[model samples]
Target: MPPSLVTIGHATFQSQTLGDLQSGSLNIFLPGLNLGLHAAPTKQWVIVLAGSIKVYLQNNQSEANTAFVSSGTSGILLVVDTKDVSPVGHITETIEQTALLFMPTANGTVPEHRVLHNHVCAGEDLL
Candidate 1:
């Protein structure tokens, strides 16, 4: 199945200070031999912090296609859909052992730390 394109944009929020917004979490996936196939666990943002990754996606009627994302030196962000209409997706391979940051949406209840500048931060960091 071919992949469908969704509108995305990179917006900057001008805040005096980073305040408590919503419940969110961070996760880092280390460079593995292979990431394999799977769908997003939740509606979240996948940030490529380092290396490169190719996302494979397809709908019920289209052929799967590839989307390449890399951090270069800084990073790249991808907003993924975990809703019912989300296309079936997975990571076919990592060109450079990718590092991913997953931040769930505010509407989700992922039992994550939601406080800003708190003693405990919720998320996973893998090397």
Candidate 2:
């Protein structure tokens, strides 16, 4: 049987008034979506809101490791040591699609919550 559709809500973040909040701008990954192997300088956190997927990592010794992540699951906090951190294996989704949130860790900086849709006040709805 196919997996049921999950209703995942977006998170809200605190931003300056001058900043505009973009909604529905999230990138969705369908089944069999290949996010070609790539690496960054800092560590990254990937949150899966829906569906499941497999992840492969290559070590310095040319060795590779694999990990599985389920729906509503999160990937390990990985710090890329080199510039070309490529996936040694493939990631296959167990479900139809997966929703993921990716954030990079930096110098004393943290990821913020972002709402998917805008919420208007009662009186503002009339405008």
Candidate 3:
């Protein structure tokens, strides 16, 4: 499952345990900051607070390959395209001033999660 719905302390909530979080950072990306065909330095989760970004797969250049990650947890990203691990990566461009939280996992490991639909989870899926 993507996010499990569970009850804890008489309260039900949607949650998913990723893994041990290393030292993280709240980053502020200014406008026009574009990393052309860049891979992630490490495996980390990114939660957007404000603004938006566009990510396109390295080999593909098409609308369907473009991912518009906007200001929300709904589009949470787990970037793991390291230079040595991955031959190619994605192209990232900032849409505006963006505030993001980068939480890198321990040992550069990525958490396991089931893809719901188009890599998106709906409210009904929780039930």
The better-scoring model by lDDT among 1 and 2 is 1
Higher-scoring candidate on TM-score, 2 or 3: 3
lDDT of 2: 0.42
TM-score of 3: 0.80
> Residues 32-126, candidate 3, lDDT per residue (tens digit)?
78878877888998878898887887646677667777875565777777887777878888899988889999988778755565432334543
TM-score of 2: 0.44
* Best TM-score among the predictions, by candidate number: 3
Model 3 weakest lDDT span, ten residues long: 118-127
Q: What clash count does candidate 2 reach?
A: 1
Per-residue error at 5 for model 3, in Å? 1.6
Report the poorest 10 consecutive residues by lDDT, candidate 2.
Answer: 118-127
Model 2, 124: alpha-carbon shift in Å? 50
Q: Clashes in candidate 1: how many? A: 5
Q: After superposition, how far is residue 7 of candidate 3 from its true place, in Å?
A: 3.0
Alpha carbon lDDT of residue 29, candidate 1? 56
In candidate 2 the C-alpha lDDT for residue 63 amounts to 23
Each candidate's lDDT (Cα)? 0.48, 0.42, 0.76
